[model samples]
Target: MLMAMRYHIWTEGCQMNEADSAKLAAGLARLGYQEASRPEEADLAVVNTCVVRQKAEDRAISYLGYLRHLKEKRNPGMRIAVMGCLVGPRVDDLKARLPFVDIWARPQDFDAILRELVPENDLGGEFWPETFPEPRGPTAYVPVVHGCNKFCTYCIVPYRRGRERSRTIEDVRREVAYLCGRGVREVTLLGQTVEAYGKDLPDRPDLGDLMAAIHDTPGLLRIRFLTSYPKDMTEHIVRSVAELPKVCEYFNIPVQAGDNEVLARMRRGYTVEEYLEWVDRIRELVPGCAITTDVIVGFCGETEKQFQHTLDLLERVRFDKVHVAAYSPRPGTIAWRQMEDDVPHHEKMRRLHAVEAVQERIASEINAALVGTVQEVLVEGERGGKPFGRTRSNKLVHFPGEARPGELVQVRVTRASAWSLQGELVAAAAPAGS
Candidate 1:
């Protein structure tokens, strides 16, 4: 028998963390646990941490400090468990810095954390039956694989989450079908290196085959995937997205640096020229596809010439959007061990702004072209007398409409900004309400 317990989960980091939290919530629910409306009233609290960057770790620690205060003053008996990228054996700071944490579960300690924190008689080996959180909305993240095989010099994911391991194509199809059956219209296949999905599995079905399996899932209106590696992005995968009816025309392929020298230093196999060729191919294959990327400025010893190359790439590529970050050090990454953190803080900021400025200009120009066109948007929510959603291309569109989250509506793009589109509903659609 399970005791009456309520848990509050504090999630941090990427979509992988969010999916893990959803799975954790589902397990807790199966163990007869309810969610606490407030952290102070919870019997158990889980801090899902992220150590991708120094700032993420600091943010988690800050929240844990406050949670510790809550536990000491109002809920001393409450069980506190910390899990995710920041709690693994490699990390050495949690014990001294935040001693109030009752249990520390490493990145792979999913069942152990739940069993100890939930106080159950037996959690039997089978944890996959009621394996997910209830699908409450239109969009859900289904992680196709866990961890990264690529140990990019500045990256901490491989160190934190371990090597690449993929869910079988059958398992992935089952989960996607489950989500769609419960009113989830859109599913983004998640992974640290999602492009590397299905490599470890015995049958060796690639991402295209996995998508083909899920493309016909009933009630599924749209599908997407993220964080693709440039080198592994095959012509077949691009063809799959282009030809598949349900797949959205959005590709989030990251090219960390534009200079070949910098890319080589970072251990990214593909050169800048090769990356540009891939971009050209995606655009040629999937016209009007929303191609987005990530850029890290001032990595270790990157020079002014390399930074200019990045700007030139931005000008040449003109991506739909760019996720820009200034370089930051981590404890065990190759950059930390082998290279100098030679880029000064202020210089890093300057390079970051320069990169952003280039992308912002490119995005604004690209978005500006969307004016006077009709876009099919998935209504996500409303604010200020307008509903907001994303186009199949993943551009955020804010429009005047009566539709709520989950409905697909047509909107005429009346205005455009660098980051979002402003429009008015052109067709009425029934909302897929909660």
Candidate 2:
């Protein structure tokens, strides 16, 4: 009998891609393949890629080229596949461009790729699995929806990943239950625009309804979702965070830009006033909610005043964290066709740093407030002799302790830095579920 081959998967891009990669891994395990610790140690390698920016796409293609040497040296039957947004439009072209790549599947056909890995079933019927698997370990990504309906001018997601499609409420519940049974304590729901979940489905069970259902789930300690579009954020979702026991108060809403005119140019759908109002409402409902955002600096035609508006908005909103990026033109997007990437590279860097500096000061101030509080934290695990966990508000905490992983504990924060809290564990405690 042939020995089962160990496989390695390398992922790039957003939370959705990470979830897709996890599902693919579970499918591979069902087909008798175990995970390898590194790329070179495996008989198979899969690159689940992202195409959000021009540089990211270039990096994925270049990385695929680099792996050609491994292909040449590995077993004659070693398999390599490329999936996610990178394989969307140019599947045939990518195959033609790099014939060394053995499989070209999109995000939808992840299960099919796993079946193709089986030597005797290269053409298995409907090989794609329908249900999310019970993960082999503690952490997992659960994608409640896929694709985006919004056609942001600079974004390639609408063109490449296509329109939004939500999984059924029943399906999501079953998936979460399966993961929980496998000792999974935490799950982050994934999507291109997660707030837009359930739009296409009949009866339209929106994000709030989904969260309520998940909150009722037994044995689930932590629940979170990501990449919410500002326009689709409903008041109900805000209330869900306030009311749901398991829902983390941390919201990852991406404001993108702060000026109305710049936002109009970017087609963000919400103005700076509207964004701030929503933030205000969130703060009102969840006082200690740790709000974070994504900011795009130097969008097309952004004037100095508009750039200052972004900084001003940051100062006002005081986001706990900000993911700052300089705009890069992507092929086949509205901005690429209509606007100019005239913002000089130096200017983009300057604006990005300016935004970062303001964010650093705000983060430091906000974190400093937690210095003497004992926060209830779900003990995640240990790294480098220190145990780490996440607070109810999703703040990361680590300290010296003898607590077992997955136990909830109260940690008195001895020190607070701009980004995270450092402390010592007071005593291991139980969350409501525990």
Please tell me which predicted candidate would have the highest lDDT against the true structure.
1
Which window of 10 residues has the lowest lDDT sum in candidate 2? 119-128
Tens digit of per-residue lDDT, candidate 2, span 1-434: 98779888888888778777877887887777889998787888898888887777888888887678777866556678888888767677778888998887887667557656664555644454565655644456788888888899989888777889999898999999888876777778878899999999999989999988887677788888887888899999899989888788889999988899989999988888888889899899987898899999999999889999889999889888999999998878899999999899999999999999999999999889999999988877788999887887778888997876667789999998787899988876764335
**Cα lDDT for residue 167, model 2?**
92
Clashing pairs in 1: none
Model 2, residue 353: what's the lDDT? 97
Local lDDT at 296 for model 2: 94
lDDT of 1 at 416: 93
In angstroms, what RMSD does candidate 1 have relative to the true structure?
2.3
How high is the lDDT of residue 344 in model 1? 94
Off by over 4 Å in 2: 74-76, 119-137, 431-433
Which residues of candidate 1, in runs, are more than 4 Å off?
A: 1-3, 91-93, 118-129, 429-434
